[model samples]
Target: MTIAEAPPRLAAAADASLRWYPGGPYDLARTLGPLLRGNSDPSFSVQGGVIWNAFTTAEGPATVRFNPAGGAGLEPWVDVQAWGPGAGAAIESVPRLLGAQDDWHGFDEPAFHATLPRMVREARRRSLALRLPSSGRVVDQLLPIILEQKVTVIEARRAYRYLLHRYGSPAPQAGSLAPAGLVLAPTAAQWLQVPSWEWHRAGVGPQRSATVMRALRSAVALERLAGLPALEAATKMQAIPGIGIWTAAEVVQRTHGCPDSISVGDYHLAAYVGAALTGQRTDDAGMLRLLAPWQGHRQRVVRMIQSSGFRKPTFGPRMTIQDHRRH
Candidate 1:
């Protein structure tokens, strides 16, 4: 999707601020929620009503601060600040990051109005404010997903946190403007330098580590995918050895605000979605069939159903625990 026009320049460039308005009702917390791994995630954080992210740009590492200046509805303009060598590029992408660039496209097709469940329809009307955020940082988003491949959520999260704390640097040139303890994920070169033993220690197996190395080797090319269409970006991500449909969909969902990409292989998504929509668990194929009517807006439908309080029954484990060490 095309980016919204460049945000208006702030009066002062102390931290390189850019003022921007959303194309629709924009909810700051909801838009940003999916990008953050968890509260303790090192690469992204929310503190003191300010959202902080440290990212890798072609120029260098940059620290971004999103400060929302109040107004009602779409008038709430966001003032974004950036620091470090890549500050200019980082400042320029703030609107895209918050999904201001996302367009609903054919979601409003007249024939599709009643296609969604009544609960979700109500949610859609109330949640026009919900947006799909795009960080535009490919590798930073990829590594953690690599860690998650075929593993439990606890395992992936722990490994990611370990790697970030061990290899990530404090946001460069951020000085006092950045929150205390804010950290950036490792740069592409730094990722390649992580020792085999360290990967083992982080709970990443040989196959997953190999995938990480492959992705880093093609870092420049992979980073360019951020500029491509979300569908095309997801397709290109599969060219990497360890990336697959599931990983690609998850990555592009955040990096490109891909509305149609589905987490087809996510172990629990099918069941969760199936139960939410039909009150009975179903497999991935069933889930896809159910979502087919809204071809271009499947993820949006999923998000609406998810936010509507319908949940998969508690008859089974919330998440699968597949031990990868046996591999």
Candidate 2:
């Protein structure tokens, strides 16, 4: 299914401030772009007119489309010209998730507001800034975080792309914004059915793959966990066998904009936060102390720091990519 042209109103929304998709809102596909682009390991094969990684911006509910009129592959599928509620209401909510609304604008505390500007300015000199976009669905966002546990990003992304392409379905349409080889992510049932060899083929080792299967088996229970507070959600996610503090924090931060969910186990986050906040590199405890002043809004502050343009020096050896497929 292809949309020939993005309806006129959606074009206007794109003109305003929405950065991710100028066309409209994508439900689950929104998460895919970040996963693919953030880490190079999930390199999608962009063959055919199907720009599989493109996010669909419909006037109503979010969906993954092939070529829904607006040009084939990555042209940005959108439908915003309609005036009625069905799709239109969904379109309006897009801005809220993107933080386009003014009410959601302010940082939680005034003290944070005061300190962040300096940080932003400092970051500006270095050409870095923190950015946060509402990633729909806690489960979708949490998956990669879970896969990345105690491993390199390259390893995690490789595992993700392989899993999705092999087990996920093809988008209803041929070639659109969805990844060329990817359709929707594996459903809970599908996840449970995957064979052990397929996991190995996807470069996901046994441990992470098994954890994913367990989570998928309980997908319904996990989806219900969405509305919980970030901390609470983090706790629930951690209860899973392979998931841990760092992964849960990583997932919650993007899933709900949780203010205090600093990524404690990230390979580079603590150092990055340390150098960004203070001139020197620090460990997890030090990073927490630095962010303590903005306790309730810690995630927000980290977003600011990232957006502020600070860069952690990178002289150390990068983590080598390990292809579990060979194992």
Candidate 3:
């Protein structure tokens, strides 16, 4: 919000020094928040007012650090630095990674907010700092999400950290400037090489491991989906076995910034949506029916209301997480 209306474009000086602006109410953390699995996540980091992201580009591995710069009443601007062979590609991805490519027009309109629940309306007023970033890296988004299928968040985060740390190599060119011991996620070949025993050690059961292996076999096709429309990309993803509506939607949410993609099979999402809307719990059908009024911006609606901190009362006991490694 502190940024000027006509943000400056990065000069063609140095690829590694690329920088751009979101030109609106952009909050760096909010834009990239969903990509982080946990503090132990190898790919992302935030410290000392800077954010570092290590990822694989088609060219190779790279570490990107982005910072929002503002002081002395000056309008805030973004600063970016990169390291690796893929640094140029990583630099080019800055815009989409900060949601410069996103279109949240209708969702921001006051008229639209007038038709929503009071909590959601209030959330929208405060949520201008958020954006749904499209990372445009399909395999990068898909790997951890596949491991997350039908599992508790604790289970999923554990498995993701284990597998990533074990298979991923040290990120290239991340010196003292980058996060200490930062790691890049494994390449498709490295992922294919992971043994079943290692998967067991990571607490990924046979079914989930098989699904990941199957999806990796189509890595080329999946990577190509970034160029397609979000809905069509989701449909193509569903054609793969073990990738249902939930997984496909989740993938497109990151890779395509698909605003309408809802995690229909999620354990808590439907209840959360229901609670935010009417202060009463509801099933997936009811959530869908309630969200139907804003079919195109459903995910935007979810983000806003959930950001409002209004949710169904939690009186029930927590479900015990299954330890798949023991099986």
Provide the global lDDT of candidate 1 against the true structure.
Answer: 0.80
The models' CA-based lDDT, in order, is 0.80, 0.56, 0.82
lDDT of 2 by residue, 162-272 (tens): 677676654333222334443455556667888889878877788887888778777777766667776898899878887788877877666665657888867788888
RMSD of 1: 3.1
Pull out the clashing pairs in model 1: none
Per residue, candidate 1 scores C-alpha lDDT tens digits across 94-194 of 77888876777578666678566776677688677788888898988888888988888888988889889999988865655567777888888999999
Off by over 4 Å in 1: 1-13, 72-74, 173-177, 318-327
- Per-residue CA lDDT of model 3 for 1-327, tens digit only, reads 222212234323223755466666667877787888887798888896688888989888888888787646655567887788898888778778888877878876778767876776788877887888899999989989999898888899999898888888887765555677788999888899999999998888899999999999999999999999999999999888999999999999999888899999998898888877888889999999989989898988887776666657884666678887788
Ranking by lDDT: 3, 1, 2
- How far off is residue 292 in model 3, in Å? 1.3
TM-score of each: 0.90, 0.70, 0.93
Off by over 4 Å in 3: 1-15, 71-73
What ranking of all candidate models by TM-score puts the best one first? 3, 1, 2
